[model samples]
Target: MRVVVDGMGGDNSPQAIVEGCVLAQKEYGVEIIITGPKEKIEAELAKHEYNKNAITIVDAREVISTNEAPVKALKTKKDSSLVKALDLVKNGEADAVVSAGSTGAFLAGCTLIVKRIKGISRPALAPVMPGKNGPFMIIDAGANADCKPQYLTQFAQMGKVYFENVLGVNNPTVGLVNIGEEEEKGNDLTKAAYQLLKEEDINFIGNIEPRDIPKGKVNVLVCDGFVGNTVLKMYEGVAETILSEIKTEIMGSFVTKIGGVLLTPVFKRFKKHYDYKEYGGAAFLGVNGICIKAHGSSDARALKNAIKVSKVYYDTGVLEKMKSAFAEEKDTLKIDE
Candidate 1:
């Protein structure tokens, strides 16, 4: 499959992005089109040995910075790496678009340019995160701050499709994130969402508390972007703080240092569980075409994994499956004209 990557969009820019594309091309056997300034992208590519035929460069002169207004940037930066890369997917020239750019801009470009799938009110950002049992997905992660109960139901549906198809989870269980585990514990939104989700065809597991998220009680956690984003950030912060404290304590004294050396393998494995690079990026589900929002600070390894994630999304025919599933719900999703 062919994947278009925004080579100039990340913190590491063309270097990490170019190297990652090369790694993905070599390891995954996928054709990559890197969009950025030709000279800068090529300079990075020349540093590594890669199959020239498998990787192509598309010139995009502009870049949308993180601080810029997403909607305005998307409209004006037509030649930006992010916009051009997305255009490839919109035009069917590429199977997916991956960007380690401004998250807001990426989401805006996907909605305004690539467009959302039919019957989908707003596309949700679903990020696969490490949980106790394994990886779980959180939908609407910083995508839509305010949402209707029906929107949460749609998120649950889309999240289920992705978990099963992309993550290889069978009959994934869905849960609405709430303050308490009881069905009637949450506010109007969660309570209403619980009712909707339970009646759907998915494996609804009722309410899931934020405290139980790390336990991996459900395969898909659904919430409004406001709550989901808060959960995601808090999780990251806690993990980082714990790891940092552990390391500091491990080096506190010679005795602890010796113990630390002996426990290095265990610590390494534990740290891997929280590494964002392991999951690559979050998928902009409900978009008409595949769009992966890689972490802005993504390194080569993370970028490579993000491209790999895109390949898996494309190969699984996820967009087709989502389209069909949403088609069946179109009648229920519509409001009176």
Candidate 2:
């Protein structure tokens, strides 16, 4: 499989991105096309020893910043690394596109340039997070801050297909994030969404309280972007804080220091569970082509893993499966509307 990467889009820029692409090419045996200013990209690439035939470069003169307006940047910056990389997927020159760039720009570019699958109202951002059971995914993890009831239903359906196909979960349990497990809990949106989710042909598991998320009670957690984003950030913050506190205590004294050394492996394993790099990036579900939104601060390892994740998405044929499912549900969807 071939993946088009934005080599100039992240905080680490060409260096981290290039190294990551090289690692992915070497380890995964996938062809990579890195898009950016030719000189900058090549400079970092030359530092590493990799299979020359497996890596290619495409020149893009512009770079989009996080502060720039997403829609405007995408429309005006035709030669930008972000836009050019996306074009590769739109034109079928690549199976997937990976970017550690502006999240807003990535979402806009995919929705406008690559487009969304038929019958999908809005594409959702679904990212897998470490759960006690393994890993669970949160759909609309900051895609649409505001959504209709139907949108949540769609997120549930899309999240279900993704978890099942990509993560190998069978009939993944779907849950609506709310204040309580009761059917009548939540604002008008969640309450309305609860009813819709119940009617859909899915493994609806009812509501999921935010407190229960870490327990991995459900495989797919569906909510509007606002709530999902809040949950994701809070979870990350809590995990980081806990780890930090643990490290501080472990090094406080000679005895503790010895204990730290003895338990280093255990701590490493625990940290790995919450590390964002482990999962690579979040998928922009419902997009016509594969588009993965890597973390903006992604390092070389994270970028490599993101590419691997993209390959799995491509190989699983999740896009085609979503298209078929949505197409078949189009008629029934209208009735429910």
TM-scores, one per candidate: 0.98, 0.98
Q: Superposing every Cα of model 2 onto the true structure, what RMSD results?
A: 1.3
The sequence of per-residue lDDT tens digits that candidate 1 reaches over residues 1-337 is 9999999888999889998999999999999999999999989999999999999999999999999999999989899999999989999999999999999999999999999898899899999999988889999999999888988988999999999999898999998999998888999999888888888889998898999999886899999999999999999999999999999998899999999999989999988878998889899999999999999999999999999889899899999999999988898774221
Ten-residue stretch with the least lDDT total in model 2: 328-337
Where is model 1 poorest over a 10-residue stretch in terms of lDDT? 328-337
Clashing pairs in 1: none
Off by over 4 Å in 2: 334-337
**Tens digit of per-residue lDDT, candidate 2, span 21-132:** 9999989899999999999888898999988899999999999999999999999999999999999999999999999999999999999999988888889999999999
Give residue 163's error in model 2 in angstroms: 1.0
